[model samples]
Target: MVAGEKIETREERIPLWKLKLDPTNVRFSHLPGPLSDKELEDEIWKENETRDLMKSIQAAKGLIEPPFVMEGDGYYIIKEGNRRVVALRKLKEAVDNGEIDDFPASYFDKIPCEIIPKKIDPIRMDIMLAVWHVSGKKEWDALNKASHIFKMHRDKGLTYDIIAEYIGVSKSTIKRALLAYEECQRFLKKYPNDPVGIKRFTYFDEFFKKSYLVQKATVDRSFRDKFMEWLAAGKFRTHRDVRVLPDILEDTDATKELEKGTIEDALNTLYRKYPDRGDPLWETIASAVEVLRSMPRSEVKAILEDQAKRHLFSNLVSEVDTLKAELNRIRNGRSSKLK
Candidate 1:
């Protein structure tokens, strides 16, 4: 039960035909029009692990966990486990056609379900779904999660605070998801026929989270469009490449390399221009400093009390001192050359 809303639920076995797929399901929200049951099943089949789930269910002979649903007049609307339902339906088809004969048709005919009353408040229902998929177990992929958050805030007109409170996430997380979702939508509008572009939600999400990149894109529409074009062109090898975009954008040579060559080429150009930034030793030292700064006081006390830990700490200090001396010597050598 979610706070402030009293939900009435009952367990029952529902016929497969009587269970309706939710068109507003976050997984298929990108589709434009009303979808038939077959269409919903087709869409659900495209989800990750659907085939694996079908095999798992075949071995188990039934669902391991019942799907959650809402009671309708003559049917029940599935709120969770659409993929599982699709798997069952497909398995049933196989059985009807005699594809595999391990299980009978009866196993797939009636599915166990946890049915919530349709009379429940719509907002509460949305909140409950958000809690389950957004922050709870049975989590949706990043794209679906962001799309759900976007709909709740934009279509349902729910405030960020309300969503964050209900979904057990920070308000900033909700806002970031909404921003990334909107950007992805804009990308889709530009390339409506490009189905593969929707899968790059993580690239857009990571891009929006970087303040430097966001500021640049916010102030310059051309830069944003160029980034979109790069995304659509599949220039970024992975989403991690998006993390170094700020550095690439800051360097003229690196940006040119990125436009013409690969992300690796652009990174090489950036590293060449700022050699110090690419130094592994400097990075290690910086990471060490960060770890030390963030270490808990309890751990620090334990280290002080333990001889082995204190010895290790002393060695680390000695290494830092040696590094500092070497850095000063190099600096002084460079100063002498300038003189």
Candidate 2:
């Protein structure tokens, strides 16, 4: 229900041969070239939870909810429930090939479908799919969601706010999806026919979360290329490693290490060059100093007037002095070694 659009629909039992799998299904949109019905079925089968849906259908012996389809020239294109259709097709295939025949072949002959008008506005179709998958009960995976959002914004010329309102997400969420999707497109363009760019899209999504990293990559083309190369090479072992990219890029030696090594090597170089950046004790001491510097004068006076508080303060000062003496001795030893 996109605002004022009224869609006319009817229910019917459509034969499996008359139902065409949509090649432009959001789940497999990243795939290159036109896919045949069998190819589409195979691709949909590869999606997460498709196997589970097949199991559920096998247990139930029929679909719980009918698939929604739009009438095409001589066929009906599956809109919603692509996975369910794929599942049914697979089950039928299993039975047809004599692989396993528990149920009758008549079960997969004709499927119940909610048929919509073929001439329904394409935008309405997009909105309906978004409602069913993006913000609805049967949600698409993150990469699939991003692909749909990117299509709405980039191809359809919809605003972020408009898409957010329809998808039940914030404008910022839409923006992040766009960024991640665009990065994935960039990767795809550089390495055509490689599904890894879309498969490992969360790595790019994590990379775009840090504003500093995004800005750096935007301003420096070489950095951007190297980062994409690292992404393709699987240099980032996990998405969490993408979070440390800003620190790695900030240090010259660490950045060079990352160019030739893994994120672990870059992080080790960064920490070794800047020990205080990685030291928990240094952070604790710095936090303590900031707290004391910002302490209220009245609180400090009260502490001085109370005997118990004064004793605690004296102990704190003694501990600080001891730490300072230890640090000074280490610095002196290092200086002596240098001399």
Candidate 3:
């Protein structure tokens, strides 16, 4: 990794774990999503870290995983790390593009670090971004926050699964929250029009982003009164399930059919047979149907193969050889009878 050492191209198949680090050629993925805002905000710490990193680079001259590069010549931002990379880029771009009129005192020391071309390694970068969002601390907090509200409503005689999705969390999480909400009756109230209000609350993104306690105290207070009134009337307590009307114009025909209960008996029978296959299952099946509807005849086999692999249902995949063998066996039995 020294100045005399060779730099390898992307095509080189060095095991990802084996990269040597050098100050000159050391690589790190600079995607925005991976960096937390706090890490990016600290200028002094970053400078010291960079300086120490360079010293290490001069000593070990080893390559770590080649820095993750994004598009063009800049580091690709996945989420949290964008600030750091962006800070570096802003300085570099200003200096290199001659955009700077009055260079700051720190500019001289920082400009060299900013020289990294902002290039995104698309494939790995995308996977990393998805991984961070799902597995990151921030997303977990958001999910937990949404789940708290969802459960609270459920304990006050609301159905949780449907309510959960409106707030952006899984049904199971909503179920867990209901247990806690039930015990927090001292803090909660009931309302007559609370369901409608709760429905409206879905549009309030600000409420969902905060901690559960903050949300319950500040945002839900007005609605809590309505919930208590509604409880006295027993409207929510008696309600079996909530049904939302479809907003799409194309769905008018289906909606009418559903309202008339022409399909009700059949729908009930289907549900009884497969109780676990709810709306979620229908959503998946509908998506699959849409894919099949758009597929061309020539691509059907390829599509089937892809589906089989994804579903792990390769046993259901039929090849021409199996069909031919079945046909041959039938033909041979007929020929022997004829003879």
Estimated TM-score per prediction? 0.78, 0.75, 0.20
Best by TM-score: 1
Candidate 2 lDDT score at position 58: 90
Q: Positional deviation of 35 in candidate 3, in angstroms?
A: 16
Question: Per-residue error at 250 for model 1, in Å?
Answer: 2.7
Q: lDDT values of the candidates?
A: 0.86, 0.85, 0.37
What is the full ranking by TM-score, best candidate first?
1, 2, 3
Query: What tens digits encode model 1's per-residue C-alpha lDDT throughout 178-263?
Result: 88888888888998776476777888889988999989887887877898889877678888889989888889999899889887
Candidate 2 versus the native: TM-score?
0.75
What lDDT, from 0 to 1, does candidate 1 have?
0.86
Writing each residue's lDDT as its tens digit, candidate 2 over 156-255 gives: 8888878888778889888888888887788878877554657767877887788997898788868767778887776887878988888888889998
Model 1 clashes, total count: 0
In candidate 1, residue 325 scores what lDDT?
100
Given candidate 3, what's the lDDT at residue 60?
Answer: 42
Best lDDT among the predictions, by candidate number: 1
